[model samples]
Target: MLQTDDLTRYCDDHRQEALEELEAWLRIPSISADGAYRADVRRAAEHAAARMLALGMQRADVLESKGHPVIYGEWLGAPGKPTALVYGHYDVQPVDPLDLWASPPFEPQVRDGHLFARGAVDDKGQVVMHWEAFAAHLRTRKSLPLNLKYVIEGEEEIGSPNFDDFVARHRDLLACDVVIISDTPVFSEDVPSLTIAVRGLVNWEVHVDGPMLGDQHSGLFGGAIDNPINALAHIVAKLKDEHGRITVPGFYDDVRELEPAERAEIAALPFDETAEAKRLGVPQLHGERGYTPLERMWWRPTLDCNGIWGGYQGEGSKTIIPA
Candidate 1:
């Protein structure tokens, strides 16, 4: 049996090596949304499976999916211990507007005690922390506090298209006493928090096609037809009220209201509106009335257009109305 001091030393010795391996793994461009990077995404998944096996997972494999592959691993040595399912994503967001990045998105860099990379905080870093914890336990001959299973999907950034189905199909394989996800932020830097509830999401794209069959002369057809761009703007403007409440019918019908004590608890959190505003580099904050910024971010539901474009987007002026 390994002693606690031996395990501590092992973790200290291997921490830097583990971080370097993480950086190498992050270098793979696993953008699942882009068809061109499909192979890279699979490569990343396979790499993750291998790493899990090396970390003492009894069964580790890339579970094929219609989209990207899912890396599954489990260490079930502790027979009587409770099982915990840990979920994370290996896929990353597409780095469009590449010029915005100070460094290449896939090139992990450490500066001032923080790692800057595409998947650093979003998921990879968080997932690696748990792996490190497991490695420490193993090195010390200390079994984990619970049976652990890792489900790292490769399409979370793309709405996790296959996740629900995979989970349903593998109910027995994924059975666990508790599910732990590290995708959320803590309440404060000093106070760690465990999230018990997650807000569900619904996404829709409103594509407005222009009336013109093709680009037409603006001088001739500009006033004759209702511009789709203008119509889209008007439609979006009608989605919210002056008080920032969504105008969609029945939008708030099922929304739950916080009790007086809950409201008080939320208000009691340490926050500075002015400091937050300064941090965001905004003159002031705006949101639904009667709620604090924390409440608005965590508890409130919101509606806003993620992207809108209808006119000529290229450089220089074009007098043609695009269809």
Candidate 2:
């Protein structure tokens, strides 16, 4: 077993080198969404695979998916001990509205203790943290206590379009006891925490088409047919009630009810309803009848109308039945 003191000493000595490596990685523009950056995305994947090889992993290979590539690395010497599979993405969000950035997104900088970059947090930085930590343990203790595997993908920013097929095709290669995701922030700097649950996503775009042809004057056909915008508004309003509970039937069937202890723990968190209301410009707070605001945010499922549009959105009003 490796001593804690040895681990600490190794990290302290190699910390600066680790930071430099992270900065170099941050320089790569691995934007998976845009086809132009596909080569850069592959380079990022190759860089991760190279690190795995350098860290003495038994197998380090870059697997090509239909879209952006995936890198898998493993050190499976410890037969009896449990194996850990780590997952992270090397791809970053597309940087648009370029003028808004105080510094270039790809050129990482450290100012007042925080690293500034596009992929620094979600999640090249997180991936590098895992890599450097493994390097330190190897550099100091010469071995990890258990078998470990890493799977860094380059398509997460685009919703991992080919990940399901990739995993199915290589199921045997990725078999492990537990999987860890390193894509989210720590709960707080002081009170370190692990996330046990997160809501699943279902994405879709709603387009409410009304008239068969183009725009007609509202005065001409106001009462002749149903207003698509009004219909959409009605549908959206019925999605939740005054108490904020989702109106969709059977939505709560799979929802795991939090125990009393869990509720108490959530309630103890620092909160001021009035202050939050003021900050949000909300007159008052509202949510599912029984749970506190914290529980609603953390555990409860929610529905939001992210985007909606139907007719003219210009300087002034143009009263027309737009399709």
Candidate 3:
């Protein structure tokens, strides 16, 4: 059986070939948000299953889902050891504003020692890393230290509409002692870290209905009518104050304050706010008041309107009170 050193040597020797395989997988335009790329999403799932089988997984197959398919793979030879369910996604977010891309979003490119692709970092790249590690163990050692089961889905980019149902139906099939996920970020390129906890999300959609049946002429009903768009803007503005404190009542009541040790741990991490701000091309940092950027990002609960639309949007002026 091969040792860790042997596996490391094998990986180092085949690094270029691994990169080529990753690039090939990255070429699939599996944008789950758009129905146009539904087939492409399935193709990505099939590719993942094929790769799992090639990596010597005892079982590798694509499972049906209400939305996009899920690829399940397992190697359960290590009896009595803890089973780890590896979770990852193959689907990617839609690439919009195509002109902004340095290269085609589907075409993976290496620039400045960074791989550039839509799902490269968010999930698919990390998924492939797990594959490589597992391959090393199976190919050289001929067995794993512990059982591993992978559940790579293709609808994560679309808010995982069918994921809950899928999980509910596959409870026994996915039973595991712990879950291993690589869908989060490290502190920085220099610091390889694991995320302990992640902030939960709650989404809401508020609608503003005007008296008019649809958009009305501004000349006829400008000041008299209450525009839904204007009302929405007012409501969104009231969510947070100028100081960046959320003004919504009871919004922070359940927000658990960070322990002193947790705060210290976060502070000890290498961070340069100035450099981060510069990298993001922002004039300065802004977020929930009285919290560090990292704290707000990793722990705080914040609200922002993702989308709001009900008005004329054209080159020429079409003044109207949108309904």
> Which candidate comes out best when scored by TM-score?
1
How well is each residue in 127-158 modelled by candidate 3, as lDDT tens digits? 99999998887877888779999999988777
Per residue, candidate 2 scores C-alpha lDDT tens digits across 3-35 of: 599889888888888888888889999999899
Which regions in candidate 1 have their CA more than 4 angstroms from the true location? 1-8
Top-lDDT structure, candidate number: 3
Report the error of model 1 at residue 311, Å: 2.9
When 1 and 3 are scored with TM-score, the better candidate is: 1
Report the lDDT tens digits of candidate 1 across residue range 1-323.
Answer: 74578767887889889999799889999998899999999999988888888887788989987789998999998999999999999999999899998889999998898788889887888888888788788757757778999999999998998888888888899899988899888887897677767777778888777754777878899998777788889999999888888889999898898888877877878889998899999998888888878788778899988789877988998887667
lDDT of 3: 0.89
lDDT of each: 0.86, 0.87, 0.89
How accurate locally is residue 18 in candidate 3, as Cα lDDT from 0 to 100? 79
Q: Candidate 3: where is the Cα deviation over 4 Å?
A: 1-3
**What is the alpha-carbon lDDT for the whole of candidate 1?**
0.86
Clash pairs of candidate 3? Answer: none
Sorted by lDDT (best first), the order is 3, 2, 1
